[model samples]
Target chain A: MKRAELIFQSIALITLAVAFILFWNFGKGVSFAENGLPSGPTVTDSYVVLQENLNRMIPILLGSILLSVAIAFYLEEYLARTGWKYQIIARQIIILASIPSLLYGLLGLYFFVFQSKKGSFFIHALTVVLLVMPRTIQSTQMAIRSVDISIREAAFALGAKRWRVIIDHVFPHAFSVIMSGIFTVISRALAIAALIIVVYVWTKHTLQSGDTFYIPGSAIVLLLSSLLSSVLSSFLEAKTNWD
Target chain B: MQSQKTDPILHIHDLNVWYGKSQILKNLTFDVLPRQVTAFIGPSNSGKTTLVRCLNRLNDLNVNFRYTGKILYKDENLYAPQLKAAKIAQQIGMVFQKPIPFRKSIYENVAYSARLRGIKQSDQLDTIVEESLRKAQLWDEVYKHLHTSSDALSNGQQQRLCIARALAGDPEILIFDEPCEQLDAAETPKLEAIVQNLKSHYTLIFVTNKRRQAARVSDVAGFLYNGELVEFGQTEQIFTNPIDKRTENYVTGRL
Candidate 1:
């Protein structure tokens, strides 16, 4: 395999392993038994935690992915145009990509948990949304940057407008790369979502349920969903969009 | 298609281009005659590419690209606010040094521009595709596989496909920017024959650094050096007995 593919798969595998561990820890923490299990009702207890974790993270993950892609599209176009403003916007994207997700958790703690009602879904989801955007923007930038000048010139020489050239030629070619980036961001979202949920649960002192061990199954779901979405989006885009 | 003598196909007057503060073209003035091959020959970095881009407003894609001049096509200033770049490009088709097939079928590659103008009927599109491919001298090779991906063709075939794509648009003028740069020894002659046959119907511009190619293909040639037009006249005169000392020096390999 190529080096880039190797690295992509390696990072994906490592993250999947880490996600599994995080979920397992959550499962153990929430269990009513001595060893990450319920005393008399294992199935019921596991189901409840599963439901709770799904309810908390799924909406945030899906919503943020959509929002991030939208923002990335606009930002990519802005950066693709020839202007001095590109450097400034690009620097901002760099700062955003480098920012730690933990900072978002801290912000979520103070603003979403403390300022507003404690442990609200909207606030937590919003925090994850904010976190997902930067990398998505960066991914979009990289994809747009990869667009060959010859492809664009061919379209332009044939009398395509700036928007038409982007929508027709630029976007389809970038779609595969952008979809991979989105998957990476989605996986990152799963990690961030897990981190935020822990912070929220610990602060709220909800120790009655076996919700702590729910992270493993959730991570598996995230990994599968990431793969599924990547394949689906790319297949659909390549089919419908490209000439 | 042209009837007026005073109205040349294209007129360039005092064109200057700058990329971020560095000037690339300087005070260039020239006229492109109708139904003739006009060659622009210059050493690398002499702004040959930049000059052709000005004709169809392709340089507008450059972020820091700024220019001062007027390029009049068919007596209309191409830079006029009322005129869109798309409108200019529709009439002026360009083929790049590298042939780029749109990752589509051979037929679709030729029909791309026609479809942009809303030509949807497959029959009509087929006719356009066949005519264009015949004109580019590519029909005999790839006619059986028009439905297959264009990427499968050889570099020479791809260049011809690009010419067919340009021709499909029904453009009045066709500009070739070093179309032979990527072709092999055998493929160059294939393209040369097509170009030689094309000037009877279209105002063609050939931008190349090769003096031999210009002498073989162009009716008239312009030599640009350091962003300035050194000489512009009949290809025979410019190649055999150039009046300008710089042109003579550059042609004879002294400079």
Candidate 2:
């Protein structure tokens, strides 16, 4: 690899390791009472709270996965292949990826939570989608870009149209790489959803009493599901060939 | 020189290609007659591959690539803006230097092109897969494992499978970009024979640095030097009595 790429990769690794260490620390000293829940919470009590949070998280997880896949398919296969729209969408994804998650949480609270008034689960799900969409689109675009030009040429030369070539030739070739990106986004979405819900729960509890503290429960379930889903997705993705 | 009355399947007139600001091919004109093997012989980076890519508009895929050329297929102006790349490719298929089968079943690899053209019937697809594999001379070795993953095939089989995929499209012209470059010396002749037999129906355009391979397969040969067509004629004339000193030196390995 080039020296510049090597340096960039090293910095990225160090940053990731530091972030993981911090996140682990946050999980270790986590307390439900800080967010206004009743004190003296046991493991079983935490499990019951976690089960309630899972009910909200399950749909958010499924929605994030489905939406990410759909957005990836559109961007990689359809939008990226077209003229003008490709550049526009690409720039939009970059801008979205650069935005902070706190901003997305605020937007979700204002728009999806207050305007729609569909309760916390739906707002949290929408927030998760917004948080993950940009990275998912970007990574999937990179995956599609990494595909060999010759493969697409061969397919086109054989008379496959833009849609047909992507569906038959490009998608199968880039599926594993795109799946990896989707899994990355899924894991990110899981963590970010927990953070957003914690922030939302805290803010709502400060406004009034009887507001349930959903953090410890949401964090536990998010951790477990992120690990489980990532492992499952990786297994399915590993069975396929990327080259 | 002998001139046959058969209409050329593909005709290039004043073809020129450019990569960004740098011009590559300049005023290249040639004709590939139907049912004949035409070889493009040149040194490395001489634009032989670029020329063949223009046949099916594959060069258009490059972001910096541009060209001013008239490529005619069966007397139809293929370079016209109205003609789509996919339509042009349906008429002219390309096989790259390396075999690239999809990460799918062997049967699906052969059936892919046909399916792209809307041949969804299982029986029709089966017939096409069988016929294409037979034509590529790969049927006997892979018939039993049609449903197996294509990656399971050996290198030679994968290369032949690429040929079968091209043939499945039923293109009138088939362009091979150094098809045997990756094959071992012993395996080269097997693919050569397949190309030799393929000339009866498909107009073959092969790009190769190997002079002997060109002489062995092509009826007409074009010698390219630094993106220029130095000499072009019957393979016998170009190989035995090349008029240009560059061509002579190139053929004799003196350059």
Best by lDDT: 1
Scored against the true structure, residue B245 in model 2 reaches a CA lDDT of 98
Q: Which docking band does candidate 2 fall into? A: medium
Ten contiguous residues with the weakest lDDT in model 2 chain B: B1-10
What TM-score would each prediction reach against the true structure?
0.82, 0.77
Error of 2 at B44 (Å): 1.0
lDDT scores for all predictions?
0.80, 0.79
> In model 2, what are the clashing residue pairs, if there are any?
none
lDDT of 1 by residue, A1-243 (tens): 699999998999999899867866665444434556433333235445446767776777777677766666666664544345654665565555555665555566556655675467777677776678778877877887799978999999998887888888998999999899988887776666555555454534554454344434454565455546555654564467434
Candidate 1 lDDT, tens digit per residue, B133-249? 999999999988889999999999999999999999889999999999888999999898999999888999999988789889998899999999989888989999999999998
Candidate 1 versus the native: TM-score?
Answer: 0.82
What is each candidate's DockQ, to 2 decimals? 0.56, 0.50
Give a tens-digit lDDT track for model 2, residues B178-236. Answer: 99999878779989999999998888999999999999999999999888999988999
Model 2: per-residue Cα lDDT over A1-243, one tens digit each: 699999998999999999867755555455676667674333334334445666876777676666766676676666524357765665566656656554565566555534565556666566677777777777877888888877877777788888887877777878898888877776676565555455555454465665554544554565455546555554455356233
- What ranges in model 2 sit over 4 Å off? A1-85, A100-103, A106-126, A199-243, B1-3
How far in Å is the alpha carbon of B216 misplaced in model 1? 0.7
True contacts kept of each: 0.82, 0.90
